[model samples]
Target: MIHQPPVHFLGKTLTGQPVQKQVRKLKDLDNIFLDQAAFSAADMNRVVYEVFSYLPVDEGTEGGLFFGMTHLYPGTVGQEFYMTKGHFHTIENRAEYYWCVEGEGMLLMMDKHRNTWAEQMQPGSLHYIDGYTAHRVANTGGGILSFGACWPSDAGHDYATIVKNGFSRRLLSVEGKPALV
Candidate 1:
């Protein structure tokens, strides 16, 4: 089922698309799911993919490609739940942010200088960080930590995915034939 402009988050609806009404979903997974039908292409090449999961971007090599996302989940009644493991980023032009729709937690942040900071994140709370800032989300409640994340490809480069993964890297720029810091 098609909808108007600015459809819901993650570009889809939980109800699934009308074209595949016959599909059946197993209810016990309590996993990350994306209602793909709620979103549409802005142009010929653009596309949207929505899903529910415990991980973000999981494991991949699309680190250099620009992509955006939004997440919505209901908080549970536990203290050990979180959207993802603590992580760090390596990109240089990412603009990332998160809006906590439910539950409470701490916004973990670390910078290139190896400094750290933590801020409380509750429902209706929002945080936006620069691309160079490394950070992650830490849930500390007996409820589901629900939030929405939306950012350009630049956002990924500015996140804490790298540190969370115990990684090291070196990139060379052909323009000046030199390595970047």
Candidate 2:
């Protein structure tokens, strides 16, 4: 249950992460690529994305809240847009909330049956991803597409499924705008 905190705490900027700073490269997105050849040919040394995770301070509880920010660099491979290596949760029933803080992007989601959904996101936009769906966010606009997300600490990422079977729809840049192809 949600309860009020007993003591005061200091707040910090989202970029201030004392826990983890993860960098994702083109090679890291191997399984989620629509154009495998393009991905393989793209510079493996290039840093494609970044993630900053902030864990709860001394949360001695199961399924506690965890927050993080993902930064997808703006670019493309062939026609497919640059996207995060999306994933489903190990605990399939767990959900997450994402709030866009910078740039523009799209949250692409799919279910086990290949049904797809896409949401246009800009600064201040908020979205929820159901635990039953596999989701990926792409940088469809210029600059860094950054978003903050919170989920259950126990809701581990299951990227294997997404890597094995990519999303049914692809977000492409059509006429300088995002188009689901």
lDDT tens digits by residue: candidate 1, 1-181: 9956332244222232211111112231122112212212112122111233222233333553322322323221121222333344444556566767766666666666656666677878888866656655544555555566555533334223442432122222224222212
lDDT of each: 0.41, 0.81
**How much is 17 displaced in model 2, in angstroms?**
6.1
Candidate 1: segments with Cα more than 4 A from true spot:
1-3, 10-83, 154-181
Expressed as tens digits, the lDDT of each residue in 1-181 for candidate 2 is 9976432223323543355778998877776767778888899878888887777654334659887888889999877889998889888888999988888899998987889989989988999998788889999887989888888888888888887777888887788788887
Model 2 ranges off by over 4 Å: 1-17, 57-61
- Count clashing residue pairs in model 1: 26
Cα lDDT over the full model 1:
0.41
Q: Which candidate wins on TM-score?
A: 2
Instruction: Write down the TM-score for model 1.
Output: 0.48
Looking at candidate 1, the ten consecutive residues that score lowest on lDDT are 16-25
